[model samples]
Target: MEAAPPAPPRPWPAALAIGALAQTLFSWRVTIPHQLVFDEVHYVPAARALRALTAPANSEHPLIGKLLIAVGIQLFGDHPLGWRALSTVAGTAVVMGVFAILWLGTRQLRPAVVGALLTILNFTVFVQARIAMLDGFMAAFVVLGVAAMLWSMRAHGAAMWRRWIGAAVLLGLAVACKWTAAPYVAAAAGAFLVLRHRRADRWPGMNPAFAIGVLAGVSIATYFVTFAPAFFYAAEPLTWAQLVPFQLDMYRLQTQILPPHTYQSSWSTWPLDLRPIWYLYEPADGAQRGILMIGNPVVLWGGLIAVCACAIGWVRTRDTASGASAMLWLFSIAIWAAIPKSLGFFYYFYLSSIWLPIALAIAFDRFGRRLRYGDEAFVLLSAVLFVHFYPILAATALPGPQAFTRWTWFDSWR
Candidate 1:
């Protein structure tokens, strides 16, 4: 029998600790080298363009992510700190959001803490957060929406409706940041429809037509409002007459076939992490430093098995937590396989990768107590791997010329 978790306590205390620890780690050496790394060249300049209201750069992606980056730049000026401050904040939000989502979904405390820890120890999330990137912002809002949706699903009456509205707004911001958020948005809407149709016993006035209409109208309005800033661009400013044409241009650019990249890996290979990207590996800060965007070997590899186990757990018990982990892992990766992009990269797996720790934590919550300290052991192993890989993952200066060789144990990773 699955062990019943004690009722969850207030989330604020845990959220505070997680936020503090994650913020400290994520902000460490973020200003090192004072130059753009990898995609920062594209995004940072695009953010600058947005801030200046000049000719737009990187128009293929939506504006909110860049606009958020621009806000950091506007406040802090165009330095490494300004460029990446919001990203660091977003990363911390992701960690706290994961904990809250787990708590709300499972009504369990242990799983929430473990999931947040694994998120902190995950190699890719850490690296991505410290950079000037859109994924971090999108991910933060995505989790917020998920947490809100979970709360809405579990609430009764008036509380349920308010949470639903909150979910819609957060999801709207997520979609405005990236189209990748669509699958989760769809999942939330689907859940609402099913619950209202067959399971909303405690909900009041939960008519299907009314609920669907509200969600659709609110989310769509939220998405469209993000584009309002585009109209204010000073150079060849976008006009009302050209709005539809602008969207078409963005679509055309996003779908156009591009030359394959050296670091590009197939979507199939992302879950196993068969390939990894070296965002930086050169002399920086007066020594050889590097940043490898890879998964934590212990947690990421174990997560695959845990995800399959979650599928089985759901089959046996129909536990919402188990089902959610399995479902999210499946959709997050599967969506990439179905996307029309001509090429894909390991980094694109960020969405899927975020689910691994959650899957593992749910497994621990449901079955791991058969072995004492099983969950703690798993977290320990993951943290060890994180430490071993930190030098490469954080662009920390290497100890010797041979250090890089040791870190790049896999020839393909080179």
Candidate 2:
């Protein structure tokens, strides 16, 4: 008979809606502890300062992140929901971006859905989204930039140029959110150059030099525009002449060794999940609550294997997408390792760990098709693990000390 008519393609609208709704539900919570948690203590006040056009409170990073947080506070008032609203939206956008990337890369809905789910359920993404931190905003922009670049690879002529511009803008905004995102911006530019070289024959009208210039120009312009308000609104109102030195001061602050931290971890231990920071832990109202900044073990451990597999696959087949992703992921790790900093924490891995879900998606797309129900099984296992770990992630009360102990799989985790 008639081969079932190819199962009638899944609607993009429906997939996007599902992904957005799931991420919103997962991240936006009304009952999330009202008291400022973790880095929220620093960022929330910075955002308030931004809203008031007062002196810059936290100059360690650029102002775009606080500006976004300020927008939330302006619209929603000063509270947890207000402080975290923009991050919640950014977190949802990240899921959408992952879906868009997989959809554009593989031209398949199943892989895109799986990738979105993986990102949505990532413990770091979930935790960061609920707090007023810069990571979620930077991550959202980074993913959008990556998706735009991937989409551009599959397009031609005007469509391709437009996508490149979009990628540059998003990546620039990412850097504006956090200077640490600079490497990702560089990675995107590098990927574009390589892709253009490989596809030179296909686009006869495209000028590589002009395209590179446009990308660089757009990125630099976007970064400066994002910083313009900072120069205007701060109490001192820094002039253009002073901006360069100001940024150097920020870099110095970042690299200098601060007072020792109890929860600090080396880059080496991040992949192994050796040390997790407890963002909050309080015993009140006859129950204990906490928000531990940790990765889901299943995704972290499994994604590591997937990244390795992608590397091997690239070596054997030279798959451009897999090779680009692997290189970017490795570059993220390498930059951190190369930096001479003694005060880094496990949270800094947020920039690198973004690739894990994408790598996992690639692995599933490439090999899972061979096994019966492989993708389905993998997604189910991740969801189950998310549920198993939700109590700790959400900071809900545990049954007792044993319940908390059971969740800590390793001594280092404890």
The TM-score values for the models, in the order shown, are: 0.95, 0.93
Give lDDT per model, in order.
0.85, 0.80
How accurate locally is residue 213 in candidate 1, as Cα lDDT from 0 to 100? 74
Candidate 2, residues 23-62: lDDT per residue as tens digits?
6565645347777888988998999988898887888888
Count of steric clashes across candidates, in order: 0, 0
TM-score for predicted model 1 compared with the true structure:
0.95
lDDT of 1 by residue, 194-244 (tens): 545555452456676777677777777788788888888887777888877
Give the clash total for candidate 1. Answer: 0
Q: Which ten residues in a row have the lowest lDDT in candidate 2?
A: 22-31
